[model samples]
Target chain A: MGETPPRSANAGTGGIRVAPGHGQPAGASARVAEAPVSTRTPGGGDLGGGGGLPRARAFGAERAFRGLTLAAGTAVLVIIAAIAVFLIAKAVPALRANTANFWTYEGWSPNDTAPEFGIGTLAFGTVLSSALALLIAVPVALGIALYLSHYAPRRLGTALGFLIDLLAAVPSVVFGLWGRDIFVNPVRDFSVWLNTYFGWIPIFGGDGPFGKSIMLGSLVLAIMVLPIITSLSREVFLQTPTANEEAALALGATRWEMIRTAVLPYGRPGIIAAVMLGLGRALGETIALAMTLGITFGISFNLIENGGNTIAANIANAFGEANDTGRGALIASGLVLFTITLIVNITARAIIYRRREFTESAA
Target chain B: MAKRVDASNVTAYYGAFKAIENINLTVEPKTVTALIGPSGCGKSTFLRSINRMHEVLPGARVEGDLTIDGQNIYDRDVDVTAVRRMIGMVFQRPNPFPTMSIYENVVAGLRLNGVRKKSILDEAAENSLRSANLWDEVKGRLGKPGAGLSGGQQQRLCIARTIAVEPQVVLMDEPCSALDPISTLAIEDLMFQLKDKFTIIIVTHNMQQAARVSDRTAFFSIEKTGDPGRLIEYDNTQKIFSNPSHKKTEDYITGRFG
Candidate 1:
């Protein structure tokens, strides 16, 4: 009864750290970090009652170890926090002074010779492009995960899974280059034909000769983010309880039925989390959007006729070319992207928390 | 209560590792047959094979014939789904579905098998819980999640779920191992009542548990000579404990070897 499952490696070795068990009242499993050698009593496991040179040395080593580990972890956390704060500080003045022109005024010519700046188009473009990307990606990504986990043969699934992971790890800039070279040009040719056939439709009419529309930019974005969503979904689906899967199989349910009844319900929390994580990536994405999107400034809702600019792309496009006001405005745009990502992350965690309650109730 | 299971030359394997080999026995119906052994001794694997659960692991292969009533369970044309439905199992850990209500967990199999009417599901769910002796404890919270139950309650609920499927045989792999003494006794007592309607094959590490709940016992040993596991003796529970014919069985029961 006393031999509980050992605390995982991260919790440090055996001074009785708590295992994360179901419904363990918080603080009941509080770990007792080992006492310093000088603090140890004569009756303790280690006999250091005399407390001399060796014991002092041992205590010093313990403090040093903990200090170094904590320092490394804190450093990483601070770096991320610093980046977020810096983005916010630099963008605040511009954000506060952002006139209606900041979001609604379309003419964004940041030249050294003449004064000009506005983001009405960029704000709309960022949200619309990312949303369109998600529309193209989430369902297909979920399907690939389901097929690999439950339907495919073992070897094929394993091999294909590795390939997906490799693709996910590839650099975003690499994907941008590849997307432009392989997909954008060819799709530009095809988009013109599409616009010709469907040009009468408002959604597909009137812009560029070759048709480098928002749809093309979104499609390329979808391709770039596909592997991340698919891999995460696969991991979440795989984490569904082994018992639930077996219990379903024992009930005479078909493979598809079991996934519907058991796997999907269990994976819902993780799937939502995965989508939010992908959205964060999409929000921060710059180079890929810059390349695939034709860098147009007009706010056309039409998906197939005109390319548009996003907040991230506008920052990248303007920062290198402009003077003071343009840099401030670009910094402000970066701030907006950062705030959206933070809100998305916080909301995702909240949703996951609510899901945990639902899961516990259902179980 | 007594029940019988007829397995002839049954062998189960995971790739080159033969998990269980050539286990043949006739377990009388409505009786509890305990399979006792040490860890990795194939008792759990043997219990799983009866319900076709061994196939869950990748590269797992079962050979020879397993039959409950002269119908070879391993026959080439046998429907694996059907075999599993007919033979339900409870695992060592209490694993009630984490996303179903307490009532739903009990009726899960019935609902999934396309039995939709609320009346039918309600009847099945209530009846199974009653049979598992869990109805009173869980009746008040039928709408609550199965995961909300205590460890023992959850185990009983799993039994109730297995009961709902109306399997001809019930196979349990160390069902009480994760529980405390009170919980263990609760399940052991439930197993006794359950045997009146189903053939039960339980694999246990505790020798005293085998003596308490089982009517008959089959002692399975690890496959000797790097082969795999095979049943060393199949006999009445008393005889296996008091006067086993096989030397290995005698040693194991006497605590000389597990």
Candidate 2:
């Protein structure tokens, strides 16, 4: 090839200067000066001053930050594993010492010389109460969430949303006290009314003693978890994309139709997650359920009868007076509660993953 | 079915702030009309007003008359949903319902209108997709999520969804602004094919697109920021591009000023 003029000089002469203050000063100018040598030589490291630029650090603060986050994430799994190990280690010895069958026996007398205790009553009551609570709470929570996100004016929605969040911040112990001291009155009268008119229904068949029953405990549980589901569902509903909502509106959808088409579908997975979280809270709830549920030993479907018990509530009520074997028995029950919650969470994740295509695409 | 659109002395506002004022334009049936303007010039606001979608936003409202085929759409007794059904809109971004399948997105309007027969929905889905020039690419994937499509395909899917209900008028607001050049050409071609069945109104920032696809062009501009936008010139595309009467229109078309 014939001798070629320098490329930067030729390029500088060809184009108009668009950016003001165009030329580089000092070291940057020197770097630009060596560009043509590298191109012309077509060899590595041919340009002068090319190696003068400082190499980036072999390790940076980002590595430390990443390690910190990784450790934080792993710490959660480690703690969970530790809890499982402790529960199992504590529980096996008690199960061996127990005179009664752990799963099927209804009575709990673990402190006795021939300790006879089982999770049958506690398991039945826990499932029945939490399920009933969700049945009552989910619809009401969804209704409140939709009202807050869609029907309320901007200022009203924000105010109401703040109030709902504050509702969530109230301690569960306060709910327990209110359920026992104050709220039980109306529930007793309502239970009497139910027993009077609807006594034919098995659940309401019980007479006279109606206060502090499964009905009361479930009602208290519903109120306790209501704010959790409502706030989370409202947030999810509010996050429905404006583009999706507008697309529905522009397609001739009525207000309800718009919500059904866009808001509800887009918020489905999030709402499911919210409901599952609420269910988890209701399942593991201790003090409030302990105070409200009448502590009885048998499994019964009579909701208005003064009889119900749950694993967490039993644990709380019996923990103070428990012996070593008694404590181990309680730990075993706690293990059962832990397993139930794990199964519930895993089921929720499976449901979410089943619709992974839609959720992922939406994200 | 095609319908003529008439807007007279229309003013739209966001709360107290007017976005567009005194927008007077006539769009003939079975023709393509383009609204061209700079950003913040209320071209989108005017297009949204045609279908009452402008007022969907909080504190937004519209005043004055908008008629489709000589019937005022904003009358007190008129159902808003009916007005929207008659005048369908395709948004700037392609928004196929994220949770819906391709077939469901196309038939979403029909389902809203209470059409429930399986055979009817299937036929309508196919026809609408074909009209939007997307049937061949998507027929096999009707069960797939509508959001899984490419950007260009999604826009086309949105077009199909809009037209499936067979609105008399279709409003497009910068439909090709988010697409690549090849995709833009596909949409422009689709717009041409669509003009035979529906009255089309499009808002665009691309001057050449307006010149190429529209029979008539309307130029909108604002005096300054925070001021309401006004119509500068409304004329035949050829005349407006070649010899605009207004100085502002000429300057805008010739790249002198926006």
Candidate 3:
């Protein structure tokens, strides 16, 4: 990105000489040399030697600031590497000790003599619940973000944005308790209504009690993740350049049309990153899902049935009554969750980076 | 295709602040009129009010009357979008929708007007690019993003996008300010050709640009810092530069004070 400006400057100079029938190539070359001087001044030693004492002091401060920021950035990578190494070391022993097929086994009985357990149902439930939660949350979040960014009045938008930001600060345990107590009944009624109308569909075909089902757990997770997605998306939408928006409007676009053309296209990668962040949050939310979902061992797609379990919830629920093997098994499940989150984050970053050239050029 | 623009006692405000007051001007069809003023003198604001683009900002609005070809644009029953369709704008900084392809950017206005036929879009894109003098440069790379182009090319792409809809009037707010001298020259040359089809109103900080491109010129100035900007003089470009009626206009034209 830094190299582009100098290259373009050189190109501009070359184009000028060729097009204008000018014979002074030396002057053009000198102009090109001058273009990059300001960019190079910070690192140049001549400024400090020839200039006043204050110039040397400012250069020292700049070097110290750069060094401090570089150290802080490297520290983050070191900490992340340390965590990954620790999780893998704990997870390896448990996998080797397992008697049954760790990949396909349907149940967890790691405390048994031959200690058998697998992540099949737990991983499935984790992915399904989180994916469902994101499916429910993202569209609604985008709607609210657009409303706040474009349609709502300024004061109302700011107030609503602040309230949504406050929602993100609420503890997960509070959400869990609220979901368990207050939100469960309404979700169960909705699930029953869905089942009555759409029972032929496998996911809604279940007839048993529906209060502590995947539907309920996912609804709770969706609500928990909603604020993060909405806030991030709102920020992205608001950051759509005024010039671009005016360009759309001047081209005869209505307000919504302006947003469709200028704001949404600009915010696509950002909104994707925001949704992936929400998915990550939903995937690892232990207490909320544990409290809302029925902690069953079997895998089923019947969302209205009281039978679902996730990896994080399993760890939280099973950690209390576990022996050494059970504890190891729980850590192994955690490692899988970490891996899933890592993949989610990496994919999101890749999507954003793919459009970096366009976005950076605009800036 | 061009339509005359008439502004009568037009005043603009941003919240409680009066930006421009009691400005009156008439822009003839198929003619290029330049609004030349110092920075902060509200030339851009007055230019924006002609197409009702100023009101897009919160608490920014215009009063009195602005009309196109005898139809009052700011009437209570007027559709703002339709008004904008008849009048397009090119901003100071080139702003082609960064995510769109060059082809998409050229057809963006047409898409808004619901012209979805591929053949029609292809024809319009080629014509508009040719009009903006950018077709040969960008014809092979139409699928590439608009932001991938050089700054001058991006500005021309914006011009192509604006002209693709065939607006009757084109408003440019300091279009050449962000461009290099060569690119500025290219745009100035384009303006001369464009005036044969569209009424052009350009707000420029460069006196030479006004002298070079505009058929008529309006000079704007403020008496003091907090005072609203007023139109000091309006006349033929040659007359304004050589023999202005107002002392302020002469002072400004001679670079004595802005």
Candidate 4:
């Protein structure tokens, strides 16, 4: 505390981000790093440098914590990156041999010796069915969320919420099995009824899968993802500020009105995130659609008639028997699916981030 | 007097536990009535009963007649929504709807009641804002979300929202406790002006505040002898503070006991 130190020791020890000589620590910013780590008594003969042990222990503890976090986070990132890399390496030859037209031209011949593979049909089926699934899931999911958060009594809400979360945690294979045996069989009549009554719409207008079509696949996918979307949306709706809710009710608004003004407003970002989570689930849905969709590799716009295959469903159905180019092309499809999911997840996060900022500034 | 709220022999309970017993009060139109008491004296609880706001709590039941202008609010034929529509309320903390803009926050009641006319909404919103004395500060930022406003502004915004519905009576529960001195003064002024247009019933811990703002004050005390809470005094502001009819009231105002 008595002696003055040299400039370099002062600057470096001060923990300034820049190394410009003679520059001091920001007046209020006061670098606590420079403060001695010792709690030595004032007259304890220069404290015997006791600061070293605790400083080292604290540093070690902090470094260990940060190291563990960074390692865990990076491991996850690297694993995903590795998977993408593997998919790209496997698919590059197929993509190089074919052009963007590979995505547009409708032909599947990965099994043949000189077979040309095109994802045109698969891409169309995937996008169309996913879009349809979103259309079906968003409104129902939001409705369930609203009911769970605002309409239901406390005990009932807790029970129903638990059930929804349990449904979400059920294995995808089990959902597929359920779809094949129970849900699809029962709902087949409804699909046929739709085709009969309102088949004028191109989606429902088809030659009839006898209840096995792209529409059926979309529906199965939608049902499978319903709990996921609903659960996430419910949490977001529940997180709506209590004051915000009461404000609406005190204004003579109905329960539904309070939800519209407060619950939905606070939950917009979460709802978008919920839909994306459902979309991710839909993109990867394979066994359920395969069992129910009557999978065939053909391009058709009529959703009620012929079965359409998603990227995941196509891979599952054909990956075992596929040959060299066929395997490569299938892996290529996997790559495209991976890219699409990444785009969806990243976009969802970006939306949530922007929404947080928007609400923060507004608040 | 154009009485806005009349509660006769009104008693409320939660399950087997009686919360407030034998409350008789009349709130006149264009006048302020204060409910002052120590904690758990049913001051806030009684205030909420007037607007049926306390009914939102589960297992809360009322055992006496409550009316606005002689219309029984709890009658089987009465619509709860219509009853609440006539009596607006502000809470302990400023509770502006977080997601809505200030404009939307004020006009939410009108919108929900199917008032789709934007011009009418605009005019009402402006009038309410002016009545709450928040118009000049928040006028240009009606499109901005309400939660962004400061605590005092948010409280004022809530008052504005209450005014927008044009209710017959406005019930406030510790409306200025969360505010600063300046904010509290602003609200006191707002309340003074608001009494000209609507009946006001306020629950406050500040006896000085009660003395300043209220024309009539109901002094309440909790009796430890029974499990249920009892209302010890109900009188004019002057009598309650200057020459209270009850010992508990004297003890409370003279700083002898809570």
Kindly list the per-residue Cα lDDT of model 2 for residues A96-159, writing each as its tens digit. 9999899999999999999999998998999999999999999999999999999989889899
User: Interface-residue RMSD per candidate?
Assistant: 2.9, 6.1, 1.8, 5.8
True contacts kept of each: 0.60, 0.82, 0.85, 0.55
The CAPRI classification for model 2 reads as acceptable
Model 2, B188-214: lDDT tens digits are: 999999999999999999999999999
* TM-score per candidate, chains pooled: 0.80, 0.89, 0.87, 0.88
C-alpha RMSD of each candidate structure in angstroms: 7.3, 8.5, 8.8, 7.3
Better candidate by DockQ, 1 or 4? 1
List model 3 lDDT by residue over B110-200, tens digit each.
Answer: 9999999999999999999999999999999998889988889999999999999999999999999999999999999999999999999
RMSD of 4: 7.3
Off by over 4 Å in 4: A1-59, A350-354, A361-363, B1-3
Q: lDDT for model 2, please.
A: 0.92
Q: Pick the candidate with the highest lDDT.
A: 2
Instruction: Give lDDT: candidate 1, residue B173.
Output: 85
Model 1, span B117-222: residue lDDT tens? 9999999988999998899998888988888788899999999998798988898989999999999999999998899899998989899999999999988787
Which lDDT tens digits does candidate 4 get at residues B1-258?
224788888898877778899888777778899999888888887887887777777788887889888898988898777777788889879887666788988888888788999999999999999989999999998988787788899899999988888888888999999998898889988888888888999999988889999989998878763455667777889988999988888999999887
Q: Rank the candidates by DockQ, best first.
A: 3, 2, 1, 4
For candidate 2, the TM-score of chain A alone versus the native chain A is: 0.84
Q: What C-alpha lDDT do the candidate models reach, one value each? A: 0.79, 0.92, 0.91, 0.79
